[model samples]
Target: MQIYKNLLLKNQTQSFIDDKKHEKIVVSNIQSRKNPEDKEDFSKLALANYLDEDTGFNPLGITAYKMNYFLPFAYSFGSLGNDNRKMEMKFQLSIKKRLFENLFGLNEKYYIGYTQTSWWQNYKHSSPFRETNYQPEFFVDFPLENHSFFNNLRLGILHESNGKGDENLESRSWNRIYASTAIFYERFLFVPRIWYRIPEKRKDDDNPDIRHYLGNFDLNLGYLGKDYFANIMLRNNLNLRRNKGAIQVDIGYDIFNNGIYWYLQYFNGYGESLIDYNRKLQRLSTGFLISY
Candidate 1:
């Protein structure tokens, strides 16, 4: 939720105009006399279509997944007070798709998404993987036009686990139901989200009091700069007596006018990863991202 708001297709939906009509609109200020059909034609056939159109085997409703990749090289100075573990590497790959549109005769869209993040101890002898977090979620997005600031709302059910069972007693996992809405103001975007964790059986509960560290709600703020993007994520439990939370920052700049960009990130929190869910961590990293 760190403002990964599809930058590659930022202007993908721009209205199109014929050569003659375009000249008149630009010169005569007759913008209201544009062709609606031509606009739709250009929108659907634009370069962004190649990246988002449903082209693969769609045995079911319209389904298309877009790749979101982030690969980073990191170094942690305060490694939770551990030695020989300061230098590390990390990567995250995410994919999401629209499964169906206009569900149950309602103008709502259903989507499925998955994200995987791996933490590697690349400086070690074996270069072992410290931990990997896997998250899969299903959500419904509803478009809104009533308010000028609010544009979209979403509700989702999420499952996140480290995939480590009895092997690691400290393995982390959780199930949540969340609601989110996006507010847009010019080039600024803000999203606020709240979630409720589902109770699990005592025997299977890995981190029962995770809400204290991971928090129950999150807020994201984003800004689209001239040639770069910046986002900040904030989380808090909203407990007056025992306040706890996390913060993450990300900045990315397009490189070579391409889809790929140079990315930089910093995180200071209690739940940075599945394995380190209960430990405090401060890390900084730089990498490349291919996002849309």
Candidate 2:
């Protein structure tokens, strides 16, 4: 009887140890899924955590959503307008905040993002801002696993406007819901997105024909290098009869290997700005960029 009791106690102890081991394994797997083994992914996680530590914002940390840059000299190929000068300054500010992580146990995260781009005619009298575009969006990001080239998928709703008021003739605004994906191959990354504009009443609609220039789809291809990087953005209306499109290229070199980069950008096409969505533009700009 004594021997039997001792054996039963030992078996119970062994069973508890085995259960703990299994629990640890499960936790490790989940953590691995949350943090991927890519350079960009790791940097993003690090930036978020660092921001949280500095601002004491808990889990909500703000990070860069798009490229942040300031160009002092952007020269246009031809005349812009009577009031506008051929050479002007341009800048962009973009940011994002994470709202939730893994809400549905699917390794998905939610974020809110805002981006603003401005074209400033500093050389002109009074140095007025020619045009400014504002974009705000809410998105959910899903990390993919074991895919040959696909790395991430995102679904989002976006609103963009020039903020000139709905009643004003200079008003330009639109709302869209979009789907996009991130594909990675070697040192290159490709992001393609398709969007459907939300319909509005004819009376309330601003820039009704904006889609003919801005298009329903766009592609961003980038090359990530150790000391340099380059990106290309392409957009088209996809109309066979009256096709219209735009292309932008950006090249940057790491300055001092810090987060600052010397940047050069060239844009050729329509829809570069909301106020001039229908006008074609060709510009070359050089400036500095801040990256994480």
Candidate 3:
């Protein structure tokens, strides 16, 4: 009888140990599920690894140069009865290289990047390039997965200019010191940015009153999901009486778990391009977007 009692106690002890192990496994699984939703630590992840990462430098420059067709087909209106009113196309090409990682004891990465966006009047007789905006930027990314709402911070200087002839009366250009922040809320991401135009010589100021139209700040909202994504941008002049602003909406569906997506974009407002900074436009376009 004593032997039987000892055997029963041993069995009970083993059963208790197995139950504790199972509970620990369940807890670990819960944490794994929450990590992706909560921990957006960009410092460790290469730029190409993070899904729905904001527009910025890829630290490793894994994809050194990339060209994406932003809007291959679109009908634009509100040209104010201009001759070039018709179907148009737009595309962008960008390149990035890492300058330094963990710069000077600070946990940050420095990068140099150049991006060019072109608007094409494909239906025109000469197939003229309506406008091409060239942007060169030097920036630093500080990755912090802090307890606060802000997840990342970036500081940058950018020069944007339309490579247009000085003879063109509608010439536009600007230089700015910009700051961007990435905020995460479960599955939603918001990047609110602000910029101050670097003062140019009075003689070189192409658009002196641009602030009245383009404003000093903009907001970007994004949703990073499993199979689909959506992003929206808002900018305004903050003048309540003369309220002027712009809105851009982009939606995409992941194709076959690859980085390529079926993308649709829509814009309604002013400042779609440097040359058209003052022209109010309503454009709807569809194309493919490839993002790493």
Candidate that would win on lDDT:
2
Per-residue lDDT of candidate 1, residues 1-292 (tens digit): 3344554344333333355667876876434324332222222222232224545455653332322445557877576443447778888887677777886675787888888888888888888778889999998878775878886788999999988877747578999999998786767768899999999999889999898888889998878554467889998878889877889898877664444669898898778886676777888988887644
The global Cα lDDT (0 to 1) of model 2 is 0.84
The positional error of residue 91 in candidate 3, measured at the CA in angstroms, is 1.0
lDDT of 3: 0.76
**Model 1, TM vs. native:** 0.76
Candidate 3, residues 1-292, lDDT tens digits: the string is: 9999999999999999999999999999778746645443322222333222445554565443333557779778666345775588888887766676775666787877788988888877888888899998998888776646776688999999997767857678899999987777766778888999999888888998788789999998877666577789999999999888999998877564445668888899988888778878898888877655
lDDT for each candidate structure: 0.72, 0.84, 0.76
Candidate 2 accuracy as TM-score:
0.79
Question: Which digits, one per residue and each the tens of the lDDT, describe model 2 over residues 157-209?
Answer: 99999888655478899999999987767777788999999999998888789
> Worst lDDT window (10 residues) for model 3?
42-51
Residue 116 in candidate 1 has what lDDT?
Answer: 85
Which regions of candidate 3 deviate over 4 angstroms? 1-67, 80-82
lDDT of 3 at 203: 89
The per-prediction tally of clashing pairs is 1, 0, 0
The CA lDDT at 95 in model 3 is: 71
